[model samples]
Target: MASSLGKLSGRRVCSVALGSGLPRSRTLGPAGGRICLSALGGTGSAQIRGLGSGSGTGGVGAGGGARRAPWLVAGLAAGLAGVAAAAFHHLAPAEMVPRTEVASSVPDKADDLALRCSSFMTQPVTALSELRARPGDMKTQMELLIMETQSQVCQALAQLDRGATFAVDRWERKEGGGGISCVLQDGHIFEKAGVSVSVVHGVLSEEAEKQMRSRGKKFKTKNGQLPFCAMGVSSVIHPKNPHVPTIHFNYRYFEIEEADGTRQWWFGGGCDLTPTYLNKEDAVHFHQTLKDACDQHDPGFYPKFKKWCDDYFFIKHRGERRGIGGIFFDDLDSPSKEDIFRFVQSCARAFIPSYIPLVKKHCNDPFTPQEKHWQQLRRGRYVEFNLLYDRGTKFGLFTPGSRIESILMSMPLTARWEYMHAPSENSREAEILEVLSHPKDWVH
Candidate 1:
């Protein structure tokens, strides 16, 4: 259990120091260093402080504005109690064990189910080519291909949201990568969404090729690491109505084989959620659902990643976190291609349990515009983190042949930037503020 817990931590929570860059879509803090993210005004130090028991927002900087107070714990405790009540009433998976938890059950290739997702999605390149029968040239073809592919991806994501009770409305490409961006908005469930998947591969530049050869890495088909091709999915979802919160997940497979048919394969992916308002009952429900899936594969797995998820998403700047975090991991070097594939499959299997209930339970709950405004404001912070500091965005941008649109797929549909705005006193928005200002565990 401890080993699994540690791995889960490495996969999810502790990594927030690595993933905190996702919120604003812009880099905000110093890399691998502390910066302040406390509610509006704070002590002008790296420590996150002064979040409140009520809706917390803008305040003057350390210069002279009214200082915001640290988050409220009692309020959180009360809310957590409510959440526990909610979870007690909801359905939760049992402690049943699967027929096999041994690593041997892990598959050697990409799971048929995941590869099948491609089939559900219409291939845009072909559809565009056919539509442009009398078209111009390669550049036009590439442009049309990218646009059409994005459209398809957008539609697919919308369908997923609609089916799950989330709303994803506006999404525009950031223009640069062979990626399609999408967002979910203004729904009983989801509020903001950022999701995109990219496929990139090419011949390495001389400098890059030198680095590859130095590692003795070879190219495809009995050659050198001169050329390569890759693909994968990545995404983030922010729900509206604070009660519904946010979530993120991704799954991918990569490979390299030499001319002699010798090949190396790997699998990488993860799924997690961030709820601004902590509901321990909800957290337990969410965690337990994920735990069931992990147990199906290995009962020992749950404790590891659960703690990891908790530890990872901390926004040290604020002395708080983006939300009650889920799980995160990358670059899985598997013992065998099959094992790598199974690992990817196992992670993918956990997504439904992680988020479905949040939407079902809260989508129909009544919420006011004022409360939504608070959610949007929080979404703004999310935007800040993603744009300013997300490592994935940095990696995709700096890496040659990276698709920018896909790299930035984790953005919200609607966000606010008020010179100085906040929720009304004693409002639902205030309720949300109470949670964000001071972090709470709903399930606990």
Candidate 2:
């Protein structure tokens, strides 16, 4: 557990730290921001001082900041309680586990089923701390939900493919958090597949805070490293059959301690499809499923997130879309935390329905060497997008104690780049390129 906590601390939490240095506590004397760190179990009476306000969009510098007062105790207590609850939930027998001790207490049957699915899987302690602290904690709940979704999606895919199962890797960071990385290589249907779930916490150094400010993050801090917590699930699937398209999904929650000891949090994630061949029906099904999920939560969500997806995944250098867009959203902390968490859950659950059927539809289809070559070429472009422009990749590379293998697990098992290669005019590949060049609405 200690090892996992350390790994989780650095995963996503420290990635945003573009670090400057931690301020010594003395510099944060009573003159700085005043915070009360005495909310949990009446630890003591004292005023804590630190620098920085905790308001930011949350993609960068999301979890680094100081908490100087009693509120600090509240946040820490919540986190510790969450972790304890998670440990108990995992170690205790089901009949012995009290309902009140559960991380979330939603009344919906659907939510219950989702929780059951999650209960069967293991979660890092840090991930549980958020839940114990606040039953409705959006960040922790989303992480749990996403982790379950990853398990279910990968399991379903494995069942369909036959004789393919993901090998799980559990790793930890010395500072404060850990994660599980699941990968399937040279499978019956997929060439490579990676699904990862991480929970991390860490402090952002002064330099990191300044860098975040430059990037438009809104926060103020006095001295000492800012504290942060991040959790999420990320995955990419590459099929063996060229006819089958590639898919990617990422869902995450982030939180940071404010100078006032208040916690600032947000949710971000999306799913997109990349096909070697464009099938109008497949594209329609994928987009429609995502739309349905969003509609169930907010009718406006689909359109907004759809546009964000198109804009975010674009390969600016090549002037092409990464794939037919699905839905992407970030910095979301509105319409109530519970609602947004449910919304994220809906999106996470939508993945299998949106993608698996397509895989089943095309997995056995015959493909010639020429088509396979095209697929590899397309994969090369996928690599380009990830290594160059993907924010998650950049952050992972920068994060402390990052496992390079897991970070690069999204890379294709095999990809080929050709100099000045172009598909034949009016051909199937060319048609796909045209659509990518100008993303179209598969569902409106």
Worst 10 residues of 1 by lDDT: 6-15
Error of 2 at 353 (Å): 0.6
Q: Candidate 1: where is the Cα deviation over 4 Å?
A: 1-119, 124-195, 203-228, 256-265, 417-444
How much is 223 displaced in model 1, in angstroms? 13
The positional error of residue 72 in candidate 2, measured at the CA in angstroms, is: 45
- Stretches of candidate 2 exceeding 4 Å from the true structure: 1-134, 205-215
Q: lDDT winner among the candidates? A: 2
Query: For model 1, how does the per-residue alpha-carbon lDDT over 1-444 read when each residue is reduced to its tens digit?
Result: 000000000000000100101212212233733333233233222221111111323221122222332211111111111111112232111111121211122233554322322322222212232334544533233333333333343444344343121111111122221322233333223434444434434443455445445546555533444444344555566655555767776655444545666655444455666665556677777766666666665565566665555555555554545655555554456455545455555565556556666666664455555555566677777677666544455445444544333444466656777766766798655565565556444333
Every model's TM-score? 0.52, 0.72
